[model samples]
Target: MDSATRVQESRVFPHPINVVWNHVRPADFKFWTSAVKETQVEGGLPGEVGSQRKVTFKDGTVQRYQIVELSDLAYFITYEMIESNPPIKSSAALHTIKLRKITHDNSTLVEWESDYSSSGNETASVVEDSRLKKKEALQDLAKALGSK
Candidate 1:
């Protein structure tokens, strides 16, 4: 098996940890995440482990994801892709998000990372595309959090 491609991005929000946590909920996906046209929970309850969601992008591609890990007290969550429209050929793809409070200013640092693999010959482009998309999504998140 080939090693998965990985991308990580982080942003510091001036808002406190609790505020950032509220905005990061799965229920609020479409509100702050760019490129998400629609999102609906397909199984279980939102924000809980084992919960699944189908997300449709503006381009009409769809992806089904399940929350594999969550810890409200730790301010962390992880999700794995279960299905995708274009069909990701990889064995697995996981997205993890973590939040930490910057004690001095009482602000929060948000870190998001994705580990994924592409099928066949699309690995390079797929990795690059995912990185750019993640960057855009983070920018949108920062804007929604009122961070400059």
Candidate 2:
């Protein structure tokens, strides 16, 4: 693993904070991102912290993730990528999605961020791929949130 590669994107949704929050919660992630082929419950409550999900991506890579933190008050959820079958290049990866209220029109600002480490010659390709996927995911979210 090398120094973490960070990817972040923000969007504003013309919906209530809780609405955007619920839509992007751990369990409902599949609803917004086409990169995920399927997701299965692995442990605990589907959307609660400590819960786990086995996610199969469209690229055919399978990975397991654990919900490490969830805060409705602060409107953020953090999860760690715990395992991968083909093994991720990153020794460690953490993803966080945060939301903030826009007081004026009751819209919501959602920020999706991911930090991961990759090594060797594949780092540039991997980072660029991750950035593209994140951008696509955010674009997909805008459609799912009905803001597109």
Candidate 3:
């Protein structure tokens, strides 16, 4: 039996729920994060469940992910990494993101979670590095959405 590693992070953005979840969920990741060099949706329509996207990072690492589940009403999406490289070359990975609107402040609370386990020796570090990237992405998205 194999155990999966989990990483979770939450950030509250100073934007409305619809703004964060629907209006600006990064149609182009390259516009939101400098870490991502490019992203191309290769299957189905972009943002549709079952759609697959190949993403190239600034470091030249590439990974492909498929949208497994998505719910606009619930404000959540689940995806899995079908292909990856290097530290995660041999790994099982799934990620889920949830959002909730704060009615009082008109803000959105984002919860991002990742479950994965790699066969490589750097399994632990790989997950940690992912956390760092996720954190940076949140900051970038905040900036893009007009937050200081």
Predictions in order: lDDT? 0.82, 0.82, 0.78
Clashing pairs in model 1, backbone N/Cα/C closer than 3 A: none
Worst 10 residues of 3 by lDDT: 23-32
Residue 119 miss distance in model 2 (angstroms): 2.7
lDDT for model 2 comes to 0.82
Q: Which number leads on TM-score?
A: 1
Regions more than 4 Å wrong, model 3: 23-28, 87-90
lDDT of 2 by residue, 26-128 (tens): 6546654678888888889887889998989888988898999989789999999999989867777888989999999999988878888877666666677
TM-score of each: 0.90, 0.89, 0.89
Please give, for residues 39-94, the per-residue lDDT of candidate 3 as tens digits: 89888887788998888888988888888888888898888889876446336889
Flag regions of model 2 displaced more than 4 Å: none
Pairs with backbone N, CA or C atoms under 3 Å apart (clashes), candidate 3: none
Which pairs in model 2 have colliding backbones? none
TM-score of 3: 0.89
